[model samples]
Target: MAPTLPFRDINVHASPSHYAFSSPSSPSSPTLVVDRPSGDLRLHDGKLLGTQRVSSIAGILGIIKLRLDKYIIVITKAQPMGRLKGHMIYKVIATEFLPLRERPLHDPDEDTYLSLIKTLLKTGPMYFSYSFDLTNSFQRQAESDTSAPLWKRTDDRFFWNRFVQTDLIDFRTGGGNAHGFRQSLGQQPGMDPYILPVMFGMLEIKNTSIKGKPLTFVLITRRSRHRAGTRYFSRGIDEYGHVSNFNETEQAIILNDDSSSGLGGFAGDLGYQNGKIGGAAAQERQVLSYVQTRGSVPVYWAEVNTLKYTPTLQIRGVESATQAAKLHFDEQIRLYGDNWLVNLVNQKGRERRVKEAYEQLVKSLVSAPTEDTEADRVTREKFHIVEPERQKHELDRLHYIYFDFHNETKGLRWHRAQLLMEQLREPILQHGYFRGVDPPAVATESKSGTDRRLW
Candidate 1:
């Protein structure tokens, strides 16, 4: 029940001496803003006014503006897995009661406030922050019971942490029959425990549209057969019409696996569609469709596995074309080099042939044509070199999200990797033996004498 401090980024590094977070295996603190008291204007007779005071409004508005400026607008009504409902409203609201924190101060007036001013000058004018010690609840409780050392003159130096109810987003399952168990590695309790999650890591993203409106996009993640219980991810619109946000505290307590097919039952067709997983094929689809459907909201993709381990699945939306194209080329090239250019007795043999063809392509600077079976015996005199297909300059946006795998939501996405493996294993290569150098360097044809690469 202790308060949480400014959260540390999951990827950040810290040495023991400077690090603040003490424990992790322990559950995270509830992140809601609770215990809010409506501020009232007191009458001369000590009567309470019906509304909050002007100062309270200013304080809340100040914090809201600060948050808006500091963080891009993510208008969240759906709490992520590790968060509580209403966590956002309460966090900004709680900052109101504390007077110790202030906006930029004007010139200090007195010698008495000089030390405070000097301390601010030496350290920082920013708000002082802290988190509750989660390791020792009793120690924190005992410490809260005691008064501060006779050091500070103002109660404003202290801050109280906040929390919300333990509500979670339930990602409903697609019926009792999921493809997870069928395509899984055969084992009751088999496979490395770590790699097991990889089975459930597959996810997809799709374009969404309402009848007359422009195409709106959403990122969807799936959670199936959770161990703790069911999670309901059914859609509902509150008084406000956001499709995914659920505001009614009165939601029926059915698990994500609610059997009653009522208010919240199951995920519809979006569950079983074909999309790239983490391999090379996935990269191609993700980048291609993303660029194809430019200028729309980006939704992160996720899903749960019904496999040996039902770890949560996640695939983030791509941001830029340059990045996307780069990632796309890198992954596809890997597949082409290692999987496509081969011929052998078995699957392994096919893989070896692909590797050989890839080496030939890079070394001889030419691709073997798939038109005939005698491509392997092709001589240097018969080689034909061609430039990569060029997309328009604007299409280079594909290079953004497609460029870097690190920028991809889930780390080490291999969506197309497996498919590329299969493709490279195929015993086909493109080349030309019946040729002449009398042809033009660039092929072109028109009404006049338009002939170019005919060379």
Candidate 2:
């Protein structure tokens, strides 16, 4: 099924009874109404009734309750970031909160809560797409079930509006039956016209041509909502194994191939059949994506800030740290296969303690003998298999490399950085990037012994 484009230009009509939202471009489009009395959402026949004020909004973000009043968050201004897979992406440039009640209660706590919300929205980076799932990478989207709606397919870790959009999601699933509404407005239950999922992170897209072949380079960094806070206030892994400031960055290249263009050289030699764009028989677009992630050390640790230039680092709970690291690596392996942990910290200094702790933690997981003692055996078995053979397998998959970046790069000797790259060359080659194309063409190229190496 084709994805439905969300309404970009929405006309919001505020009345004494309810607030009506309708698309200004489409007169026949169904209008979503939110009753002020009970805060119930229902569908209208694209007709404005008792409209006191009319305003144009980019899109509805969601609804949030601040003490005694509920406010509707709307995107006041948005700028186009770029397009991915033929879907236009937008970054929220500005936002406004419209109170549901005409005269909201003036509570001190409510004011504080509203101020916090405003500060968060103002400071945080948010991006969204009408039809594309911004929370997921291109490779993930290609593997996901396309039949699902964009809202449902979004990654929960980056879904910034998940908490506020609960009502809309519930309304979609309930089919508006409780409010005596039955019409779907020609949209599936999974797709809601009034619902927009926002992702919190960075998105950059550059359109350029290589050898006269047009292509788009996109960089997307998605931040996890879990354990997220200020640098000093939030550090280390939580009991649930969620690390602070966890983020996944994906670099993707999108190429639209056309046979008529007669593009030759770099673009023409992509190993497609007959040296053609897609294949000799079929012309198609190509997308290549590579994803990497960063997070705080998955251990029980903290850095206390005491109004000093450098904070005091403390490593806590060795037993709990082991358990947390295990959970963290397990999840990483499940998502991205083998993990190459490259730790770059000072070898001797305040940061030395952290580096040593991390190294010891890794050694314990990958080398410690299972028959040390009953307590030791029990602790290892509690987290996962820690037998010698199992530990050996884990050691092979989980590689640890520590490099003193500051010491090596001293005096602007950047050439020394190549030493680190040499160590990572093997693992990088083993785990190739994700590229979407015909399987038969790829197999044919492989059989022909062609060298299609990527750097």
Candidate 3:
């Protein structure tokens, strides 16, 4: 196959354009990377990696950093339905993981790690726009220390693991863009020339009717670009312990006075919420509540086969399932504090074991008396099952394998979103509401280009 130069046709309008390599779409062949001015194409080994036709390509999703190397992530557009208006209408059907270089560490765990990461890439449910810069925008919010130009980056904490992974990946993958980012580290950086990831579902509630105080709460969830396939197709855990689905979920609350609170230019204030709109005194008084959670493929073992109308199921064992549940709850406590309400949905059939295991684990944590009376009391009061009376307090689910992006995941998310809304509804309706108000700006800045609205 003939290797192609990435972004060769587009005018980067710079000499000595920095280049990075993507993993090969297939195991047998190497793909190409480019130097803008010279128009030279080569592989990580300094061999010339070639490219195919532009019509055959969709776009690059920005380079990803792996443990030892960097890979150019490509989204290929497929035109199975044929062409229109002299153009081939394409959809991003597949991703190509082209490696930039050979693995450096020869550890026994390296192979397993690579396979797990690949599984994440192949399985991740990603839809790309030939126009939007999903990679750079995500990195800026998640990895970049400096802010972007058109859209302001949200709080780094809003996309916690997403930022962690990208930063580590950038460090491990070596330098492509970071080389340039380093020079402007201390100095005030220019606005980023990238677009934020597209958000599918957004909730905006205007709370003016109930009380004299008028406030708005906006919630947006940016789906992880790294998504796996539907829940039914993928199976088992890879070496790294990541299961089928992995993605970041961001939740933000926007509040403003009635006068300045129209969607027309309201997002401009989001930048102020980054806790950096003014000096130290101003930052300290800001009151913004942004929280992020994650949903991934279950760590337990299960397989699905299309041959049968319904896939055969297996529980694998109780030990691993228990451990996975323990680790998950532990992390939640560590991040969000010990106050949690464990909700175990009972069901018949295979899920019975999984649900039972989770319930038992929660019971163990709450029932086990510790030496510290205060600690024991907190555990007992804060953790409990979701009974019919306390439905308002429930906010999250403990599903081992949440089929994110599928119909099943959607229903689950909607259910949770409703629960959250219910928690807020009763209080707002009862008293209109009164509290300390120092809400942060909820603006979004992006690189100057064809802009898209995520609201």
Highest TM-score model number = 2
The local distance difference test score of each candidate is: 0.19, 0.70, 0.34
Candidate 3: worst-modelled 10 consecutive residues by lDDT: 446-455
Which portions of model 1 show Cα errors greater than 4 Å?
1-52, 55-98, 101-216, 220-263, 267-455
Tens digits of lDDT, candidate 2, 1-455: 55545677888888878888888687776788888855678777758767865689888889887777889899999988877755778988888998877664477888899899998998888999887888986656655655566687888888888888876776777644234455343333523666788999899988887777668888999999888988887888887778899998888786764323331112223446654445552434566778888888777788888989888888885666887778777777766777767677676778777776776676677754342111122122111112233545554356666666676667898987786777668767777676664232222221111111111
- Write down the RMSD of all candidates, one decimal each: 27.4, 7.9, 14.5
Query: Model 3 Cα displacement at 237 (Å)?
Result: 6.7
Error of 3 at 25 (Å): 35
Candidate 2 pairs with clashing backbones: none
256-325 per-residue lDDT for model 3 (tens digits): 3343332111122223345454343232111133334444323355655758777776656545554555
Superposed model 3: Cα runs more than 4 Å off: 1-33, 36-60, 64-215, 222-227, 234-252, 257-299, 322-326, 339-346, 361-455
Q: Please rank every candidate by TM-score, starting with the best.
A: 2, 3, 1
